[model samples]
Target: MESTREPAAPIAELDEDAAQLAALGYDYDTTFKRDMTFWGNVALGFTYLSPVVAVYTMFSVSLGQAGPPMFWSLAIAGLGQFFVALVFGEIVSNYPVAGGVYPWSRRLWGRKWAWMNGWVYIVAMFATIASVSYGAGPFLGTLFDAEAGVNTTVVCALVMLALALFFNLSGTRILNTAAMVGLICELGGAVVVGAWLLITARQHDVSVLFDAFGAGDGKSYFIAFSAAALIGIFQYYGFEACGDVAEEIKNPGRQIPKAMRWTIYIGGFAAMFIAFALILAVPNYEAVVADFNAGSTNDPLTMVLISAFGPIGYKFVVAIVLISFLSCLISLQAAVSRLTYSMSRDGILPFSKKLVRVNERTGVPSTALILAAVVPASIILLSLLLPDALVTIISFSSVGIYIAFQMVVLAALRARILGWKPAGSFRLRGWAFPVNILALAWGIIGITAIAWPRTPEAPWYVNYIVLLTALGVLGVGALYMWLKKPYLVGSAPSGDATSQINTIAARPREQVSR
Candidate 1:
């Protein structure tokens, strides 16, 4: 007698007919031409830095005690990210799709465990959208020096979300152009600011850059800096947004990997400069810290600029900060919509095809874009009632992205280690194995460090949120397996839809526990 369990879908090279079918709900018409030049790619790098978010996180937390170690923490996180970026560079070259990590991991590990990768990524994206959009309001409000318009920020985020949705739904051309513009307006300014800091630091008391001052937490200098690294690291993580737009990029297998590697190195270095400049310019360290902690409107960079280069410099930094925030808002919206489109196309989400439908003329994911706007809007509304919830949500969301990164990195490493190389349009050579292993170790350490309580000065809830979010992802993945498995069986709508979904749709189940 044969056992009753259904056989899994066989992994095979997709032929023409199957490929066409998979492309149906994939918003192919909206696909942008692969016209991205190296400069456009560089602009994409700056967009990920999103200086506004970086400045906001550092000033708010660093004010408490961390000071310049904040910049050092960023460097440490960048080292870990280097490995993760390498892993991404390799996998994305082979499997470049909007779904990104989840699909790559599942394929590497076998479908039995793949769902775990996709589900965690989906939840993580949702949380990230919530957190970043929420944080946007305060940063903008700080620049304006006004009470944050709960409605205004929410509305603004929603509008930004809508614009991103439309652009993505419209086509790759628009998204690429917008991303390029964002890189210029925001990232260019950040590089300048970072440069200014480095140039001016030598003149001021340069020791502040080396000062291991504590914010009264009593943690070792290394630990404090590591915690600070979390804040800085947040700025760099979204560079993988390039991977999510793979379908729109021409020869994505080559370009996506190239984009990821370049973005990390360039963006990471750029952030380091901006951070150092901000820290060093503020020779009155206590006052800078005080202003940062006192309220949301503390513009430390502005203050530092005034001290170093006078009022003219302050105005320039302020202009750059505003532009940077605007660019970030745009990029965040783009990331959210594409992620949604990728998930919906996979039938892992409801109305998969319809939700991800692209407007042929505009080359955007119309429905998914609309829905993405709703999430940020809702988050903005939540901020009205709960002002403090913004950063907490963003911090929580960062953990989810890290987990997704880890899973993707592990899957890529496993494949390379197990002699399972799939030829793609682009490739990473030689050190893939060693670099990936190092990346995995760094990711584990960073995740564990972020999960632990960094300061007793803060409430216990910070650590609890991290734990709960982790458990929540685990429980949600299990729940999908138990309740939604039937809907996802081979050759069914979900199964077929899975082919059209982004590469990161289904994660391998085993990896979650690991």
Candidate 2:
């Protein structure tokens, strides 16, 4: 008996999407399978912005630093990130290629500009992968009843990283499936857990959200609040991961922008909801702060769960949180690998030929995926040598990504100044300039906030770690660019949109999920 199968897509709609790619100076017959759907694309970014991982990791720091008042910072930082996301939406809508910032920068400005921007983004993403897996180590340690020390953490993180790479290199089907599972578990788990905590274990009233609890000096609370806002700043990113695999999504211009925006909306809401519930349920904020101030390894939310639901219950929640973390790891690796592939395909990175080769059966850049895992794995192992490794990596990941984002925003604003309107299905129209400017403002403040010296008492390098690491990464890249000039060597044409992006006219089954 013969089997039935739906068409991959309507001929004309496929033609229009292909035409846009061709006009952008790439072959339309891409080896990458257009296997991602609108929801799958959304899931990709949403899981990457995992609420469970963000809230569980940072809620304790914010609460410990600025007391309950830090709850409002989620909205503040999220607004800034949303502005940046809007700017990205405009760009990706017009140029929905792989490597979110790099390709867009290449077209908007030129190769050198894109190269440095891509370099910053690449480092940030790898740091994020390492930091996320490292963060998960503690929870995994808790779940397994292992000793709480650097050795256990590094081992757990490495195990998780290997598992993530396995899923990532498996194929697009497995990758998207892992992301969707992560989305369901994370968002669904957050709602259920938040509501349960709010209903059964509410120890403080909602008004507690206004109290700073003498976080800063008696003079002003600005410094402490700014430091606490890192929680939101860290949480709001990962939405840009949507555009990192544009070539793998059908009707990418339209799908990717919506996916990006939704990642911010839903991810922000989930983070805020969980944070609010955890804040109100804290049985003793003063003691939690004391423990955090004393440099304890245990997180406040974990303590709260143990109080509300005994050790066994806390262990159960740890299992759920571990799943969320693993899911996040999978998405981060996928996004970073796609970026490496995009950069290598343009001959911008070293070993371009190896990284650029897409696996014939999997339709993924398998070697690039391995490269992504390898770099972060080394970074994760730093948990052994540097006691403050996680914090430094977290700061770099947030600040580095924010800087890269603003670079793109600046490029877009510059392009607008030179009279290039967004040419895809989505456009900001008259609001384009205004939104672009707002995004730049937000990015600047954010980079400063995350990179600012929160730990002056610590060693100098540790205190100014974000700035130092970011500058160091860029310094090396600049020297390489000047000497090697890799950008001048690529035969693949740079993406300068010669005409308006070809719109994908309505076609049957265009929105079908693969």
Candidate 3:
């Protein structure tokens, strides 16, 4: 199967893709050129789920909180998220709509249900971009030999955000190219550094994983482990980004589903392997844990990389990490913008018409792309107000994303209970219902694990930021839905779609197909 399913795809194949869209009640969007190949779709998801960026930014948090044993939380998280990914595979296989979560939920449950899903997902994505940008700031500071401060980090974050926006706005091809590059850097860097360190600089024994670094040695450690699992929770998402640009993929029906699964398979492996190798290679494990416990800003990852790769090689690795972050930013921006464009196309947003407009020359959603960048940039400014703003934003983002994902899984389950069947080629033979149930269960568990308050010593707001942010987004969306009534009785498309679904108590089939 060729990755690139060009417009010259067999008439039957092209028709199949278009027919699925038609079944979903949308015409093929000519505004988005179907330029993304299969691997390019995977690249979008992979880069968005960049292992290097995730592991580098989060490794310290996990290690600091729960020591080397925290590494296994990723394995647990991966296994759990695989179930969510499987459910999503079935959903995307059937829906294959742009904006992944938002559009799929819209058709599955209905309009107001989807409005909240898109709102929370979009806000979380912007926070994600800001988080990644801010996380990459210290690396940028290292690369430039600049003092680590608010001004320097903000400048660096803004610069990276601008560059990501510029490349995303340039065109889909360039965006996909950079995404592939990002995938390469993250996967290859993780493997090369992981293997190199494990071979040449291995310091800790396998028993270290069982040691909680004096935090606790009993079942009480479960609490710390769950708190540290945020890394895995955050790392496993962005696979849905493949289906986010469904209209941009040439053979989205088949390819997007495959891409989503591969992203989890490959991306999850890389994330875990890197975390394992980093933990094993820590030269002074006791002292490293001590500094982290002492509230020192010492980066355990930098120390390990410098010890293994030396100063020059450390810089080389930093460059690769920087590229991975920038690439992740680009993919995130692209996915978020496409989601915005998709929702706007349904006339759901404030400036729906302008936001939905695609640039003729580039086939990019220009206004939506700009909005994506602008929102994240505004988020970056908030980092200056809060100490450890990156961590706060990242925590909210991880949980918000979980909340959003679970909403989609819930919608799919509801539609299934209403007699919806898998229509796409990819489906879990007799396992769809069971798998969907497990996925929903896993998602709820993930949301609880990540959103649980770990900062009891901090202010109440900071302690509960993750839950607060999620509730805030949902609250605002619900209020807007009540006040504006965007899905009112006579409104176009969504309101009509909601009516059709509401009537189908026995069979949740689309009106178009009916």
Candidate that scores best on TM-score: 2
Give the TM-scores of the predictions, in the order they appear.
Answer: 0.80, 0.93, 0.92
Which of the numbered candidates is closest to the native, going by highest lDDT?
Answer: 2
lDDT (Cα) of model 3: 0.81
**Higher lDDT: candidate 2 or 3?**
2
Poorest lDDT segment (10 consecutive residues) of candidate 1:
1-10
The C-alpha stretches of model 3 lying farther than 4 A from their native spots are 1-16, 216-219, 489-514
As for model 2, its CA RMSD to the true structure in angstroms is: 4.5
Q: Summarize candidate 2's per-residue lDDT along 200-244 as a digit string, tens digits.
A: 899999988987765664435877888888888888888889999
lDDT of each: 0.60, 0.82, 0.81
lDDT by residue (1-514, candidate 3, tens digit) is 1111123322234344555565455655555678888999999999998888889999987787788988887787878777888888777776677788887787778888888899989999999999999999989999988998888999999999999989998898998899888888889998998999999989878999998776533437777788788888878888999989887886576787789889988998999898999999876666666786678988888888999999999999999999999999999999999899878777788888788788877888888899988998999997888887877888888888888999988888887777776656567768888988988999889988878876567889887877887888889988988998765422323422224432321122232233
Assess candidate 1 and give its lDDT. 0.60
Across 104-208, the per-residue lDDT of candidate 1 in tens digits comes to 665566553556766666666666666665555544554556565566566555544455455545455665676777776666776776676668643356567
- Alpha carbon deviation, residue 412, candidate 1 (Å): 2.1
Model 2: how far residue 249 lies from native, Å = 1.2
- Tell how far residue 24 is off in model 3, in angstroms: 2.6
